[model samples]
Target: MASKYRRGFDITRDSLRVFTREPSLILLPVLSLLAVGSAFAVLTAIVFQQGLVESLVTNDLYQYGALFCAIAISSSVATFFNAAVVHCAAQLFDGNPTSVRDGLAAAWRARRQIAVWAVVAATLGTVLYILDEKFGVVGSLTRAVFNLAWALLTFFIVPVIVLDERRSLRRQLRRSGSLFRDTWGESVSATLGVSFVFLLVALPGVALGAVGFFVLDGILATGALVSGGVIIVAAIVGSQTASAIVRTALYRYATTGEGVGPFENRDPDTVFPES
Candidate 1:
């Protein structure tokens, strides 16, 4: 895979360059986070309308309903924002101008498909949640393996929803799975790159955390720790933006047979070598 396409770190570097070009891309993830928070707050109100702690402990329907809705909303919000990010990144890579508004509009256009996928995602999540909560170690292991496979299978879904336009959920899943199967090296490797990037950017926060406890004392240590937490959050946001960009780029390249962005004037994967 490394021999066939750009490696993860290289993809991360290029993705960061793309992020700098469209700095506002960072806002999508932030907004998604906030939206998910608000949604869960509303859901909490509904679930606790009877009795929060008591119902959670004794009311099976209320508890499961709350869990399902929470997972669905979270999945839907994440996919929505990821779609917007992909829209913006794809347009930019295609040498076109794109703004947050335009990206949002594109995602809105695909709301139907997103909603359907949300149901599917919610069911899977609820099942996994039940398994993990009830079966202990064996259930945890099963959940982990299923989660990984699901993630890999649907790796290109956000881009597919945004870029492909107006396909049924079944078709979209098929399309995404096929594309991922073909270019997994390019797609999954980008995650490794983003993870590497996160570790690099998060180091300052790690250092601050260490110093806060080990070197500083009392309130100053607390402040250092707080600041470190903020820095780590920022690093996460930045890495998420890069991940979105690389995801868009890899999907575009695999589908269109082009380079990642205008920054790279050649295809990310050049021609296949002689057989």
Candidate 2:
């Protein structure tokens, strides 16, 4: 357990280093946010025009359908950019220079696979949402468990899709699950570390925002709020970039029996124990 935590910290630290070296990586998450937001806006507009919004509000079935579509579209956009980020991270791992343009091109090339995976993800999300909405407490518990399982199973799907575009979506998902099972169960620890780092990064901004709301007034308060918002956005972008880098490194190590970044020179057995 201690070793797992140590490995998680190392992964997070190395991922941060990669992000520092290539600051442009942050743009991937930023663009992903913008793309998803735009898609949601468009979807909302279309749904409203078609009177689906009213139906969604009044009818459970319509609501679920709308929710599923929204989740699917947003998730798909995110998956596209995540794939691009993974592509760029892979290049960095290989000691090759890659631009955001190159990464975007790679993602575009694998658009079909991304689309299919997005549908799968969306379906899972919708089912979970429906479970929570229909079954009350029991459904909510089931949804939570399934959500975590889904996350674990598909953790490496983006890297697999980016690296091996020829594989079918089902195969890619299965491969991701298999690779994760073969790994040293570091996902929970790594996630906790990343979340802790994000909290640290966002703390100042949150403090400022709270101060602005409670103590500051007028222009000073507005300035503080704006600054806080910017800082929070930066923190989110940084966290996302680091996560992608770490995930890509993990996938590489899992598949090639080699490591990049801080993982280099580390024993594979130590990283992924045979227990």
Candidate 3:
């Protein structure tokens, strides 16, 4: 059937259905982690090779703080790219016939945008930190608002960047802003839902970590690697799942002007609504 909707993204009930049907589809997150492992390895090497950590450990508190700040900035960049890749991966789960390689390539293609977002995020964070440091006026509240903004920005940043939309960042941001205008509540809820699942998965690991610390009198961290790995994996799952949900919804919403109201048994054809 012919449709008037633009060929873009929409969040929908069927999107979540796709995620639920194949929760393991989040394994894309794990693959993402592995793909970025070399980056981590390189960072580790830099820290050791340059004796930065050693210098920080031997120096005053401010030096340690500088090291941590650098790490935070770098991690934020990695996170933006990772989220973009997960967005692509979610497209595949939504039946877009996209592969992990394609997702990675797409992520690379959109690297500049992701990097720009990272800088924006970092600047916001730094501002928050500075405010907290200088005045200490409602610092927590300030940080919370900043974080919420960041989260909302993340909701459609990747999808907008990935879609073959020919628009300036201002226009993309405007469109993404419009898409989430009345739906921030739903976005936060969906985020919490996925996060809760990861928490459930990580509970055992948390318990193990606590027990290991107590049992070893803080001498040995039993299951350190295992538990850490599990926590990391859970993080990956949550991220990928959220990406899948958001992209699917965006794709649907863009096409049909519908929020994925509720999950219903749906075929790709029904879920997508002919465009």
The candidate scoring highest on TM-score is 2
Model 3 residue 27 CA deviation in Å: 5.0
C-alpha positional error of residue 122 in candidate 3 after TM-score superposition, expressed in Å: 1.8
lDDT of 2: 0.80
lDDT of each: 0.79, 0.80, 0.55
**How close is each model in CA RMSD to the real structure?**
3.9, 3.1, 8.2
For all candidates, the clash counts are 0, 0, 14
Superposition TM-score, candidate 3 onto the true structure: 0.68
lDDT of 3 at 264: 26
Return the candidate ranking by TM-score, descending.
Answer: 2, 1, 3
Identify the runs in model 3 with alpha carbons over 4 angstroms from their true place.
Answer: 1-27, 35-41, 54-94, 164-167, 216-221, 224-228, 258-275
- Pairs that collide in candidate 2 are none
**Comparing candidate 2 with candidate 3, which one achieves the higher TM-score?**
2
Question: How far out, in Å, is residue 168 in model 2?
Answer: 1.6
Roughly what TM-score does model 2 have, to 2 decimal places? Answer: 0.86
**What's each prediction's TM-score?**
0.83, 0.86, 0.68
Per-residue lDDT of candidate 3, residues 1-275 (tens digit): 21212111223223335545445544556655555576567766877898788776675554535545554556544554455455544564455665556656766777667666656665666676766655676887788787777667656665676663734666766766665664555455444545555566677767766667666543356456467557756655555655555554644555465444232232222433423
